[model samples]
Target: MAGGITDTGEPYSPYVGLVYMFNLIVGTGALTMPRAFATAGWVVSLALICFLACMSYMTTTFVIEAMAAANAHIRWKRRESERVINDSDSMSDYSDDEVIIRDRVDRSETRPILSVQPGVSPDHFDIVERVEMGQMASIFFNKVGVNMFYICIIVYLYGDLAIYAAAVPISLMEVACGNHSCSAGSSIKYNDTDSCWGPVKRKDAYRVFLTIFTLLLGPFTFFNAQKTKYLQIMTSLMRWIAFTMMIILALIRIGKGHGEGKPPVAELSGVPNLFGVCVYSFMCQHSLPSLVTPISDKKRMNGLVLADYVLILGFYSLLSFTAIFCFDNSLLKDMYTLNFTDNCDVIGVAFLRYFLGLFPVFTISTNFPIIAVTLRNNWKTLFYREGGTYPWVVDRVVFPLITLVPPIIVAFCTHDLEVLVGITGAYAGTGIQYIIPACLVYLSRKRLQPVFGEDMPNKHRSPFHHTFWVIFILAWAGSCLMFVTANIILTETKH
Candidate 1:
């Protein structure tokens, strides 16, 4: 809500809650969804979209409900503490208002508004006692053996860098979609000519560098756990405009005679695999806590949270299905726009190029702050201390280093969007974001004791509910495994 306590002893705003939902959908996922459909068929793409949408909805519901339970417990503990203090003469010397004022001033001076670290006193901590069944669903889609979700979360940490990293293909889309194809020699078959090889040439090196520069937005994570800021919101909105542009382009393509071919399938064809991939990526349900830091209605669940997931899947499905009808799998251009015109109008190309270029720039810029905050929070978790000047400094150094290292390797190693997406999806995108959370939730749930503590009976008390969660864990776990294997095969073949 408007004034909820966090681990860092600061209060957060309500709007940031929506940012989490929007950011997940509006970034790189939007850009490449068409490409995904080009490989998988239209019907498969539609199915994947439905699957992801359902998972996303259930996950968001789970997270919010669990958060509600946790906050309630924290409130109850504070009440108990207040009651004890009123009965006891131990702190009779200080007035209640004075103590509260002191705490408020101390927090305002010392903590970042977005910080989620709990206060030293358990009474001040907002504890999420029992994770809900819906929340458990969030973890289910993601917990695979090894996949892109891990890489996405580990590297991007819900920051601008992730967005930028995801947007890299958008920049290339303009060039790829142009009438001019980049064949090693004009006679090469599309599959025979590897996209990764182009960046090695001196001419394309600049483009690669530019894309990586966008990816470097990884350092911004430092501020994520701190507080709400206008700049962050505005930046996110700018990229969202790019998403709207893509949607417009899709509409335009449909209006034109573009969607008539063998339902332009994504050049890749692992439709069944989408169940796993989406389960891993969409398992982003656990991320809801990081969002809860900002809202005014701490107890009231935000309907928008689930709506964001629905909207994302809806967007993905639209693009994917459309692409399927537009081009054949092998003929499907990596960017999806190339199949449209040989004598394409200048205005259409210009619009596509301009927005495509801007999407990556904004995405990378936003990723930086998200990574900084995630690293800071993870560090606190490891060190067991409030993130202060020293911790912040450490995060500053580590965040950029981590961000810079991968892209540099990526730059020198390859520039093929397909290879990059495959590797990214297989490694970063799959693991941290989806698979790990799934495993953790499954393990954690199994580890829970049946009896709820005396302090809160409505919360974690019943062992009876564990049966449902156990089933969910198995369902998601099986799905994640399928996704991991499919990702490996698709990536290997595509590479």
Candidate 2:
């Protein structure tokens, strides 16, 4: 969730919320989009990206609606507790803490009151309280659904960590080992067997870099990791500068009529990769509560979210389109920033070239530990027992080790960013972004209807409030999973 907020408890304007959403959605996923676009063909990429953006926006609304429902439920519970206290004068003799404890024990033994009298209404869309996605799941979902939700999120976070773990090393390897003197007209591909230095192959160099990367950043998982405000400012500044430089440079080369790309009109084989990348790129649904909760003015929240989606769609289209046109598809790197390195024709300044190459190294390094710790915490939550505490060794040593080792091992085995991103986004990413939200919002509405009565109004209801929309989203997610799975199967068979 961009880590935790570093600002004072001040609410931001809607426009500021839009910017935050844009930044959140356009992280490492955007860096991998150009390669996906080049593979899938520009025309197919454009259409698919647009469709996915619409789907992502729809689910974003679902989350907001669910959040409002959660707030309404909390308000209802508090009101019920007040009524109970008022109805019994004898209860006044109990301490507040005693009454709260008694109420909690009673609540655990009782079925949730889902029925409110008709003609009663409450303001449900007030964003004063924050309800996280996990809490919402515990409130609205059945046991099976709650477990599924956590599993999906845990998987997505692991995918995030793996991508980050592989990316920085790949960037370092490219810059440290590859020649940076090549002209833009030249298309050179480095083989794994190619020597990086004395007796070191390029592939070996990548592993070494990965090892060093793990050594440098791995320990942060054992401790709480945070990005300070100054670090965030510097990261954002570098991000914008790097992105603008790439876009402008690509446009310049195109204007000079020196563009080398000849992308296809459509390519079915590349569609799966593009699907995964797009799903991964448009992932803000899970973190929407944190992003949407602190906005000062949420009167036009739907409009603001719509505007943000449009802006992000346009930004992604511009970035990828320029990239696919500027470079040949086969020559595009998994990390888009690497395209500027070693290409003097596109970027004349040597310093800027290296900066672009090393940008991910700086930005993603900040994010990796934060994500690792997040994943570790989620693991603890998943297996955590009620009222039972973990031993210090299990809590400290086991959780961090489990969180850190698997992704590192995966990164070590293969540094193929495309495959990693494709698998992660296609499966777990789809479940988290599409399927879970659909189920959560649908179940929330069903559970909330009895509590609020049919006449009670929810200000944050999704635009696509029909049952058909929920079914459509789940079916789409299921179909995408099946398609990606079958593609992997067929590809393996062919190999």
Candidate 3:
């Protein structure tokens, strides 16, 4: 329902909404998950992933609730303005003596509706109006809060671009250079110095692919790129095919008792990376506003969201479990698709092998321009002032250039998908996914109570409506940041 629209201007069915959310939540993050699972151990990874999924789902509800509240506030203001204008017009027609009487009557009639009182349901939490997260932040947050929200989103998007930029090339490098023969087995690790084409090192091959990727897809950022509905469908189809192939192949291998994995029950050292991976994988908060706004019916929205999360949780669990059990923990590639490429025992066909290996290249390449544009637009939004405009050069050239350059530079410098995802998801992602939603909902409730009164039935209020949940989410986010920061510092020190 978010992007899909009928010719008749009708919103999509709830089932379609379910599918969109599923596609969004399951992306490149899922590919990195198997390696994280292998490192963190099956049992620990399972527990942590479940916990993180629940947390993400909780914050998702918060965002939906805030959306509903924001819509209600918009509706209330429009109605109030209409009433005021009608009253003012009617008063103008009356004489001086009669004006006093009419004004008193008007005040008496409108007082009950405006004032906080029992049984006054002024704000109905129906998401008819589409208020984006940024608008909601501006409406509900103070100046500092709004700035923090923008910063978090900008950082997350940059991270997303970097991940996409790196993923495509990394996949290409692995596919182009690595042997297609199955002789390497699950235990062998490919190094950066390995030959890709003739004397071209794999690392150099990655850079070459990165440059080509930028050249081909980067220019779209300079222009307005739109009407990507078909592209989205194609990418979604490819993603499902690629993911299903890996899962089924892993299952087939494990069923035959040929799994090389012997992952530990718990690996403390791997928990930080695993935490980052899970956080990144579960991210759908930034896009939730678009996803939730166009639903034709939202009575079952909560249930639909819950079902989606449950299914994703099960899917992630199934994929990661099968992967950790099928491949040796030491040999699991950062990009899981690479695991299927050279292993003839699992995938005998060379064409499908190359397809699976280059799957990220195919899917993520399509997404890079779109994300780059989004980042560029956000840059404009962040610096935009009311009743003012940017110079043509700054508007067209500078913004897109800034958005496109840094992530490419990051990708050029390092192709570590895992670390990129981890750092991005752990820091900026935590703020976007957890802290922002919690604050938005909490602030929305606070802002709306005086206008709508305490008894106004909000249809989309989160089950975790207590103050403690907000505190808990924020606390969890803070603790995760500290943990990840400490891990990074210590790892660098050791290196």
TM-score each candidate: 0.62, 0.92, 0.94
**Decreasing lDDT order of the candidates:** 3, 2, 1
- Candidate 3: stretches off by over 4 Å: 1-10, 95-123, 183-187
Write the residue-wise lDDT of candidate 1 on 1-495 in tens digits: 112233422444444556565665454444445555655666666766686566445444444444544454445446668867774654566799877776577667943322223432232224333333223333333434223333334443433233344335444533443334222211112332335344354325435545555454433443444434675677677766655655565566557866444653342445534443344345455455555544555443445565566666666666666555544445554433333322232124545545555455554544545455554454333333345455555556664465445554554444444444444444444443434444444443332212122232332222223446435644764666566677677768999
lDDT of model number 3:
0.86
The alpha-carbon lDDT assigned to residue 157 of candidate 3 equals 90
lDDT of 3 by residue, 114-160 (tens): 55556655446777767778888888899888778877888999999
Q: 2 or 3: which has the higher TM-score?
A: 3
How would the candidate models be sorted by TM-score, starting from the highest?
3, 2, 1
lDDT of 2 by residue, 102-172 (tens): 77887788453655444666465475677878888888888887788888888888888889999999999
C-alpha positional error of residue 462 in candidate 2 after TM-score superposition, expressed in Å: 0.9
C-alpha lDDT of residue 224 in model 3: 71
Per-prediction backbone clash count: 78, 0, 0
